[model samples]
Target: MAEPAVRYFFGQDGTKLAYRDLGVGRPLVLLHGFFSSGAHQWLHSGFAHTLAADGHRVIVPDLRAHGDSAAPHGAEHYPDDVLTDDAFALIDYLKLTTYNLGGYSLGARTVVRMLVRGAAPSRVIVAGQGLREVTGKGGTVARYLRHVFSHLGTFKPGTAEWKAEQWLTRTGGDPEALLHVLDSVLDTPADALTGIEVPMLVVVGDRDDRDGSALALSRTVSQGTHVVVPGDHTTAITAPELAETARTFLRDQ
Candidate 1:
């Protein structure tokens, strides 16, 4: 059977954030990685459709500045808490007291922040992010500028350029907002992960850059499980093993 797509929008500090909903029954939100929209990460993944097939409703949104969502022009607009609030707003807008959550890479980072802030879900699945030191390189401002120039005249929406654009957009394409988010990522408090009690499954590819960190994070969480699939960062998304692993985890939950 062909899956149906539902369009919806929820307010994020007064601005509308767009989302695509599919399937029915229990709600499961899927967050995409740093340089990709929810469509590319979840819908294109076959993961979204698969979950829908199994009687799970999926909510996929392009974070604040990515995809077809609103892109405000300020640093204050994209802070970690603010971004996390957007996710919560969507949940409340849907009137769901609780649901399942999953994300990859940057999306995974947000899920961790959500968990820290007490946005507890029935179960959580994080891909690409594990445990790693939040190193201090330069401030968020410097990183944001670097991102903008790095992708100048380079990335478009739906090709190899897509990844580049994804990173550039998150950095805000504006210097101030870029710096703000970078700083937020670097300066995030350590206590955030000290006591995550929700059940979690952290999946990483054997060759993924964050493999070691993912394992470390798995160990840190009180109830976390780690799975390793074949291939590197990008390939892991399409790898059969990853799909199977995700299916098993979500089904079991």
Candidate 2:
């Protein structure tokens, strides 16, 4: 199917954000990962199509500083929990009272924050993220990204930081904007996970643990289940089974 047309809305701070709406059924908002856009994470990987085809009005937003969203170089635009704020702003702009929400990687982290801050989605999908990712101090990925950005063009070819830089360059990411976004990240305390009463699906790849324990995260939630697919941190997002498993989980009553 053809990709949906991009739509625009103003965030709480007046930053213009973009999202794609497709299919037609129960509302399902899916957020993309860091250093990736909605089109790359969802559309190109066939994840959104699978969910949309399974009777969902798939809504994927490109977070601020990623994809088509405004990438302000100023630090003032990236307040603490800024991504969470943007997510809530989008939900409010759409006027969605009841909806299923899910996200991958950074997106998943944002979903957890939204829940902690009082988002009442009917169901939630947290994929490619783990407990430490949600609760750990100064996130591993955040630190790693900081290092990569801080030393861009100085790393050896085989180093992980170099690889990350190459990926960022290929994706046309804005280092300054992304660094500010990373700086705005606020860790969610472990105790806050218990307050999320809605059913939650913790989907992670068997070989992926860059952030932390996925099973541990699932166990923390009041009503959560775990599903391990085949792939690592990066490849997991493209795994076809990931989408299929998510569909089954979200479809269950």
Candidate 3:
């Protein structure tokens, strides 16, 4: 098959968003994790390719402030639920009434927000995340965000912010914008994770202490399924088991 083509669309706030399109079937939109983009979490990790070849049109977008998407560093640009709006905009732009949706880490947080907002997707995949993080217990993730914000609009070597900036440089990202993205959605109600009727999968690694326990998160939702794969938060994104598990669940549906 030919390489997928990149497409651009404007968010509700007029920020330019980027996505990659592939295959032909029901649309499955996947969002990437923090400090990562569609290319990093899905394409490079082979998750997007797997879904597309599985007979689904995989649409993976770089959330605002990440990847090729336009990044506006100010808080005004990242109002609460901005990411959620962007997700819905993509779905609406494609005129997809029913589709699959999912995200990893920060992306999973967006999925939770979308779900609570009543965004309807046939199925949802929550990867490399746990209830604790969604419930506002993101100790480590919070620290990283704090570090980034502390040095926003400037650079200090050997810090988390510095490392993230370096990575952004490599990816052509907007570090200030990404930091604002983190600050924007740092708090979500714990009750939001419960009572989701849509088929949902919560995936995390056995060794991942980043977000507490994934199994507990699954139990809270009526239709949630938990899959414990090997590796930590970072490794789970690329872990083959993660893809296979999600693919199986999606296929079963």
Candidate 4:
């Protein structure tokens, strides 16, 4: 397997973004979760290697403000579903008319956004997330963003907010810009997710009921499949079964 190499591309607004390219076959784009970049969430977890070894050319982008990408700390840099737009830009840059795309957590939410925006990836995998995030009011995301941006270092250790701070700090992400992204994604209409024609695999941890059922979400789409893996939200992302599930779906005979 070829080692992943760092590459650069420009977003719609000219913000330079970074991505890792590996292997040599079908292009598989993997988006990482909130506060986590492509390197830690996908590469470090061995998920990227798994896909690459399965006869795929893996493309993992470090979303703006989350990795080696330019982290602009302003609202203007983040429009509604802008992260998805960035992904689309990468796809366009690669000139790939069809490819496989997937993500976990925030990246999972992004898959839904891409579907709504009419991206026609040949296959999609949404892991570690559930229905509410894709179709609910999204109040919790806004509240969490507000808490992080407002309080910053004030959150005590051992709490979720404090842990969140650490994750953002690892990539030198700007909290204000993240809040803008939250605002942009929250504006997406809940009803837009239902009749998507794209074939999707919604894989969530069986115990991750906090965000509603992944099965329920998949059933709404015309060509969706649901897979229940072990563990909760966080643990599910690193589960070996996730890579296996993805390999099976993307390589079906």
Global Cα lDDT for candidate 3? 0.82
lDDT (Cα, 0-100) at 194 in candidate 3: 68
Instruction: Give one digit per residue, the lDDT tens place, for model 1 in 1-253.
Output: 3434545566566766778898887899888875467877788878788878778888998776666666667666765556577778888888887589998876787788788878879889989776763222224423554665456666565764565556555644443343454444533355567688888999999998778878878888888899999978887877777767877887886
Model 3 residue 224 CA deviation (Å) reads 1.5
Best by TM-score: 2
lDDT of 2 at 134: 86
Error of 3 at 17 (Å): 0.8
lDDT of 2 by residue, 1-253 (tens): 8989999998888999999999999999998999999999999999999999999999999999999999999899999999999999998999999899999989999999999999999999999888878897527677778989988999999888888999999999999999999888888999989888999999998888643478888899999898999899888988999999989988896
How much is the lDDT of residue 84 in candidate 3?
A: 89
* Global CA lDDT computed for model 2: 0.91
Better of 2 and 3 by lDDT: 2
Task: Point out the higher-scoring one by TM-score: 2 or 3.
Answer: 2
Candidate 4, residue 42: lDDT: 91
Each prediction's number of clashing residue pairs: 4, 0, 0, 0
Considering summed lDDT, which 10 consecutive residues are worst modelled in model 1? 133-142
Clashes of 1: 4
Q: Model 4, 1-253: lDDT tens per residue? A: 4446789999999999999998888899999987678998898878889989899999999987888888787778888778899999999998988688899988888878888888888888988766767665446765876788789989989998898888778767778767776666644454677768778899988778643567777877788898987778777778898889989999972
